[model samples]
Target chain A: MSRVHDMGGRYGDGAVNPADNATFAQDWHARALALTLAAGALGQWNIDVSRHARETLSPKDYSRFSYYEKWLAGLADMLVNLGVLTREELKAGHATGVSELASRILKADAVAGVLAKGSPYTRDGAPNAEFKPGDRVKTRRPAHNIQVAGGHTRLPGYASGLIGEVVLLHGAHVLPDSNAHGLGEAAEPLYAVAFAARDVWGDEAGAWDEVVLDLWQSYLEPTA
Target chain B: MHFRAGQTRATSANLAAMPHDHDHDHPHTLLPPEPALRVRALETILTEKGLIDPAALDEIIETYQHKIGPQNGAKVVARIWSDPTFRKGMLDEPMPLLEELEFYGRQGEHMVIVENTPEVHNVVVCTLCSCYPWPLLGIPPGWYKSDAYRSRVVREPRKVLAEFGVDVPDDKKVRVWDSTAEVRYLVVPERPEGTEGMDEDALAALVTRDSMIGTGLALRPEA
Candidate 1:
């Protein structure tokens, strides 16, 4: 939650410009996305790892770079850190030698099939959900204890520790906090917790507004 | 050698007025090469390293650029409005119907559909990242992924909605779904009145991309 990426209810921002809807503003954006995704298909890392790498950027870089720029930086870091490439190679803007990952390249023909068959996080053998719909519950302050959470968490700062009722139980899914690190996919039950806007934002919030978050069970307190 | 304060001010004023004060000496090569060059460089490096195929990259870009997009979501919304069975089916368990309709894949693996009604308005946001239903709606628009929309939408839905000219009534309970997990959401905007005679194709025409995202409503039929 302390990360720059955990932005919710922070103020002093301009309007949401509704004019530009082009998928990619520049020729490079499309290429950047494609390159990241192609490299991702190498099967070396998961989406959670990619997300953590992207957010792990410096605060200034996180805030300053355009969206895909951050993605490019993350991809470069991930490739280098994974030993698929080297810093000197990137600096030279050329490959010193062919990578061993050649045997695992994502061919053009496989792109459609791979995208169509998306990597679904849902898995079998989930335990019974602890809390049911309409049960009043509170999210644990996992973020406050950042050292314990290991830096990658799905629960944003704005909605942390808020008291809310379980609006829906979405069965069990991969826990991003653990999955992001090499901690393994500790699949846990996820629920939609609805917090009243008035409770979260106080007077600034509209009386009838409510925010619902899809939070994993690990983020919720054991008791109601 | 530096001049005294008063002397420097006069010299600076004169220099500012002068046409050639070292300005013409250097051509504007201040910027590095455009991003295109860097992007090409990266692509070439990866390709040469045998880590990626330029063809695959092209296929990925081409698919997103042409094959997938909001039009798919528009068609789904139209079918939802025109067919009662499909609307109920979609609301109850969207995956089956979406898979049948082929609006299933990629970032939209785990899908959820929320309907907007006269009494309740629904909107979707991802405060952490841009977790969108890409198969149905394509890549998210700039505003949808922006800080202003992400930070304030959950706390102040109406204000952000107003930014897109969508004014939720005071009596209408606004429900903002912050996609914290991988589940992606699509808002089935309320069908506008006076569209009784329209077919699904015609109805799909009325569905704007923003309507499916809950920032705006479907276009009303002409009077």
Candidate 2:
């Protein structure tokens, strides 16, 4: 189902705010960012799982809360679901005396190094790529009945079900849709698929413009 | 932005549960008044549970805040401007060329640096999500994540560029790169004219975060 987070090609009420960027506006924003990285370093849940937590939030909460606030909410929910913490503890905003499971902990000293050596999504010994540059392919659309309730998917909502030309085959890599759900590292070929603006958004788009998107093998098929 | 019946109920229940004000009319103006207090609570709870280390949190923040940012990208762009071979190498094998500058990891894992020439202008947006090159650009700006930017940029690149004060001529073609996967993009902005004698450091100073994102152009040096 389409969520507020999937607002691609969706019109908004006002003009796009072109204000300058700020790293963090509020102190809590920094805390939200830090806690996310620290918890992510524990090696329990993958980044996709974290994303799913946020995606499943009540659409109301999803749009109302700011970006980092969403991060906090997702982190809290995952902690409970993973048995790291309980719902009671989260509501109370403090740890209960009862002990919880602890498999691994990211130490303070290792934080910098851990983050510095970021987790690469690429996997080893993957199969050869199916499509190459200059190949014409069509984007695969998810079946209407298909539901992605609690998992992750790299397939963007807007780019789906369209025709495009393969621009570059980025050597086989881990499929994020599978990796995000703890479904093991299912490696596959990724490609940069370039679609003519008219093909994606109709004739309203500029004739000279093209939108290039990086897509996984599963999302494409040879265009007849 | 339509919601299901279940979602509607969930929202109502959530709103009722929280002892907070709701400004449904204007969500943009909504800011949690007591964010610091809530952050402290969450941090305290996690620390006590041994799920996270406070020191580690500090280090992570410090690194993103001070160490990594657009300055690092400016260095790469500067090298490209100064060394023709390096620029060619970037267009051919981006990962290896960028790694030479130690600018590879995180969102910067697989990059394709698009050069802006006299006839074409390039811009980037992750219509799906905020898939920016963090190692090179640092954290993305809030507008980059807004629905307006994500939706309109691909549809009307020329108009969006104008809003950023970047006006491409009618003859110039606009290319929008939508980052949909691990591969990221960094726009190699056109080198400003009248800066023919600037050193590498001086050239690096002209590259801003927005320039690399293709929303703005490189700054012209003082005459």
Q: Which candidate ranks first by lDDT, i.e. highest? A: 1
Residues A1-224, candidate 1, lDDT per residue (tens digit)? 38888898888877788886778988899998899888887776677767877777766667977788777766776666566767677777889989876887899999998888777777667766889988888887745424234357888888877899898887788877765554556788999899998988998777888999999887887542
Best by TM-score: 1
lDDT of 2 by residue, A68-175 (tens): 777776676656556566666766777886344333457778765565455566666887788889999988786111222434576767788888899988888767
| Two-chain complex of model 1, DockQ on C-alpha atoms against the true structure | 0.25
TM-scores vs. true structure, each candidate: 0.90, 0.88
On residues B1-223, what C-alpha lDDT tens digit does candidate 1 reach at each position? 0111122111223212322113222111121245566577778889999988999999999999999999999999999998899989988888888888888778988888899999889999999888889999998888888888888888788988998989988889999999988888999999999999799999999998899888989999862
**Which residue runs of candidate 2 sit more than 4 Å off their true CA positions?**
A97-103, A143-151, B1-34
The candidate scoring highest on DockQ is 2
